[model samples]
Target chain A: MHIPDGYLGPTTCGFFYAVMLPIWAVASKIVKKTLKAKQVPMLAIGAAFSFVIMMFNVPIIGGSTGHAVGGVLVAILLGPWAACIAITVALVIQALLFGDGGITAFGANCFNLAFILPFVGYYIYQALTYRAPAISNRRVLAAGIAGYVGINIAALFTGVEFGLQPLLHHTAAGQALYCPYGLNVSVPAMAGEHLLIFGWVEAIVTALVIKFLQKQDTNGFPPKTCGNDTVGLNAETTNGRSL
Target chain B: MSFFKDSVFSDENASKNGFLQSLDPRIKTITFLLFLVQILLTRNIFILLCLYAVSVLLACFSKIRLGFFLKRTWVFIPLFSLFIAIPAIFSIFTPGEPLTTVKIAGLTLIITRPGLSGAALFIARVVTSVSFVVLLNITTKHFELLKVLRIFKIPQIFVMTLGMCYRYIFLFIGIIENTHLAVKSRVGIKIRPKKGQRIVASNITSLWQRSYQLNEDVYQAMLSRGYNGEPLVLNNFKAGWQDWLWLLCALTIFITIR
Candidate 1:
């Protein structure tokens, strides 16, 4: 979810920006070094797809519409480091172009959606499907589970951020100047929605895509092994170029 | 599908001759950022209303339709914030004088005076902040916004990635939409979830392959043009006297408003 301006106080926003700067720098360096010059266009395309993927409204049971975040999907296709850069680029573009997220809260948004979601999702997927062959159904299920868990974790962090605002920043009258909700309210409000609705949407999208792709191409996901070779633990490390 | 049209990047108002459109992107970004910070810091509801009125006036001067601008800014974000603000109006959250009371099933809900004021201020801040961001977006070109980010010493890699991404986003959208339409035409029968999943997966896989193929084509094109990996940007920023005057006014307002 995109956090708008005035949601978090200046101090909280600043803290996230400070924390994310180094992570972004490291991610960029890893991506530039591992990816070939030709792969630049592909990475850009991936970032663009990350931006547009949210537009696809998935029809679930109960006649409700929800969208997939596509953060973990990018990580499954590309490496986690590349996913970090790609999703961060998408978030930045969304903030600047659409004002979907806040200008001041960009760092906090990126930290939640880009860094925490993809990295956690990728690692969890790897841990679960470590020994499974790339084409197996279990690996596909792993991707789904990973997507579900990753986004929920990110939402939890955001809930904490919103919940902490009132406690951390207030006027002398004990009135909240920023988000007025405390931990008890904000955490359940954020986590409940994601856990019940959006998490399932993300899981279904991820699982279906992975299954369909594997059926089409017997070689399966991660068509290349560029960055995956360097980070040998990921199970998606097959024989395709970085997409 | 909403993906059929690009709603995020609005350039309809940017082409029009307006005060905000004429301002330097750098100046617009900095001053508006200051305006947002100031709005957030101020706890006084009347002062918040004044700042919001000023934003509305700025929108009018920018020559954007008042209804269109308000709808664009408030339709989604502020509406969502309203739900977040709802709990703040009850005395259970913030202690204050009881404006009214409601009881249901042995539960007492008191609408406190301070709670209502607090929620109102929160809404005011959200409304004002979103207004500034929406104004900046509607007035400036997408590329110009990316370029203005350079003024803040944002990473060049980010700028390059964003520029390239912006260009291909339309292309990818075309590819995706065409695939969906093609699938719809080809399938005469009502498709089940399994078939639907297969179609979506194949579409994504094809798109990935196309992206990689396009990447090779772009690489060859760049190599043929003697281009290096480094991105070369055209710096055409010329800050006029009016831009400076605008910036100065912004600073004065930011300071004096406190």
Candidate 2:
């Protein structure tokens, strides 16, 4: 779920941007480490794929269409950094070309989906994979849950970030922020709605894509242990390359 | 989804705040983030209402239609927040001062005030937050924004993808649309597409395969053009008079509301 600009108070967006930019800078370096020449186009194309897939309202729940950000799937195929950048780029294009997310909220949306998806989703994936067979169907299940959980976590971050807005003024003015809707209210709703359904879809799609990639392991980037230009990090790097 | 709708949300009064388009995306980004965090911390209804009102006014200044925003946001965000509201609705056990309660089979089940208050609070927070998000999306561009991010040294790898994804989103959607068109042209009958969902599914699989191949070709073309990891060099855009004025105005109004 893209958290557009101007959604929260000025101070809130400002603060969230402050926290997110540093992580994003780190994300960029992570991207550069494995950015072989061959993978550049794939990164861009994948970003585009993610945008369309996320925004393409699949008619579900009786004409109530739903779309996903394709975060987990991007993480699976392209590694977190590439997926992160790709999704960010896709989001930007979506914002500029179609007016999907806001201009001011670009940072917020990118932080929520692009940064959150790949790193968090990938980490969850690794946790699941570590406990599973190297190439078992259960790994697919793990990928699904990881995908689900990663998205929810991102949504939670958005809620927390959103929740922190009024607090900033108090912080700025040396007072206390109010708490009308406790973290209990906003955080859960964000996790449940923006992320939950997308999580299920992401899990399924991520599982299938992972399964598909597991079969070929050719068209995508090579594992890092391959240790060369050809050996771009794949989905597994999400665990703890900790770049 | 219409893939080019975001360009519409750029400032309607660009004549007044020209340099907002030129500010470092990173700084602008951080500013909005502060907005999100601050709003979330506020438990005061008065504060929330003030924030919500300011958000709406910003949209109005952008010259966007309120009806349009309501139609867009209410449809997805508010409508869906019912999930949170619904669950809280059932957890009502506290006795109320004759508050509205559901009765069944000569048994009266009281809807507690606290539970209802919780639900209302949940709805209000979600609506306000989501509304602001919609507002943000309505006002910015993705590339310029990401470039702002690039200033923070966010990797070119990720930036590359954002650019690619934006370009290819439209391309991929085009493929889907064209494929659908071709299918429609051939099907030419009274059969509902739903009845032939399996056929559509198979077609999608093939389409995915073809798109993959097409994507590879597109990559080759990019490389042929000497494409590197970095797609576009981050151009410098100075924060001018409008940028300062806009920022000051926003801050002043925000403080006043608070």
Candidate 3:
């Protein structure tokens, strides 16, 4: 999914970066509003978690192994802004440090996985948890299904983005190259791969991580780890200040 | 690029002269993106070498260390192999000319010419892009990078969530670490649950509940602070001449090369 550099034609790749950078900017401002200072390090560690956990390469059925992005879990714990930025940072670090993704294509990868997946997954989870009669066997089942479906849809969007490349790069001479690998074969195949494999991997891991975070901080608010917030907050408390 | 960030920001490297500590986030971002584009514009072996040289030179001038760049490649090589190999390894068995033949497990292992070519293409692309991004982080602060995002016009809701998450990520890790440590101190890494799957299930359910509660608290805090949908703005780091020059260079190369 990380479009390593130079794989896509320059025009297509450049267009994506330009498109995504603004999206990233909007996400950043949202993150600034959400942060209360105390949550900073946890998010950084979350960033680190994203960088490390995605590298685990857990063994599954075939010779291939799949990793989790933990987007839903991050959203549940940190909210979408921090989750997106943290995930973006994690992805950036993964690309720079490990070359897992391409630098030129980082915005594209970030757009698909970080921006699209978590936000979509969060709302779907919320919608399911709320609309359903109860968190019964049926509701949980529905929530799981919705989350899974949401992930697949995001995957489909990514496939389409990748598929548009050859079409956009279409020149008279490049048409012959299509005979061996037409757009028909590539786009749906990539989408199908995501829907079947990547989505499932994302769904299960996300569900697990979300479930885990919910378990540990049973009080809902995470423990305080920053002194600035506490000092500033406590000072206000003592001085009888209120926003 | 990787080396530049590691030397300045890698937890341990902060002690060195913080040359990159004060650059405008927007400048760092624009340069980083352009540098990535520069790498992407080349496929010829000579151009790849030149791209690598340019990135290295930039890092040296910026005073970021060489070690930071190489340290990150450890995670990439293995992970990248998996990324490219699935599609690539599958292509080898499609009845093409065998590039190499080997015997294993009483069967012949074949690498086809097409598969070999595909792998080469995949590797080259991965290397060229990853290297440039490695440079970006080495030269830029993560927070400043986020500021750059806001300036670039990404959604405020989205950025706020990411930034708050970054701020609080450590708190959750500490809690989780303490819990893990407590479990270890008492049980010393038990292989399996004493009961059945119920223990694991219960643990998972508890975690889910906690995460929800945490977000609820976060919402309360935000509501009390007047968080109506408008995103907070840094209002710094405007794009200047360097950005235009960099973009022009990228545009020129992209059009001329292909």
Choose the strongest candidate by DockQ: 1
lDDT of each: 0.80, 0.57, 0.53
Proportion of true inter-chain contacts also present in candidate 3:
0.21
Find the 10 residues in a row with the least total lDDT in model 3 chain B: B193-202
How displaced is residue B247 in candidate 2, in Å? 1.6
True contacts kept of each: 0.49, 0.31, 0.21
Query: Which ranking of candidates, highest lDDT first?
Result: 1, 2, 3
lDDT tens string, model 1, B1-258? 462254565578987899999998889889988898788677788888888888899999999899988988897888989987988988899887788998868998998877787788888888888888888888887788878878888777777888889888878878888888887788866666545545655666677667756776887887787768877898897789999999999999989988
Candidate 2, CAPRI quality class derived from DockQ? incorrect
Which pairs clash in the backbone of model 1?
Answer: A223-A239, A223-A240, A223-A241, A224-A240, A224-A241
Cα TM-score of candidate 2: 0.63
Off by over 4 Å in 2: A1-27, A55-72, A84-243, B2-35, B86-118, B150-153, B184-238, B256-258
- Tens-place lDDT digits, model 3, residues A97-129: 445666666767787778787677666665655
Cα error, candidate 1, residue A219 (Å)? 9.2
What's the CA error at residue B101 for candidate 2, in Å? 3.9
Q: Point out the higher-scoring one by TM-score: 2 or 3.
A: 2
Better of 1 and 3 by TM-score: 1
DockQ of each: 0.54, 0.22, 0.17
Where model 3 places Cα greater than 4 Å from the true spot, the runs are: A1-8, A11-67, A70-103, A114-131, A153-243, B1-11, B18-25, B57-68, B77-79, B82-118, B155-160, B189-258
**Which tens-of-lDDT digit does each residue in B36-65 have in candidate 3?**
655555445456556666666665666666
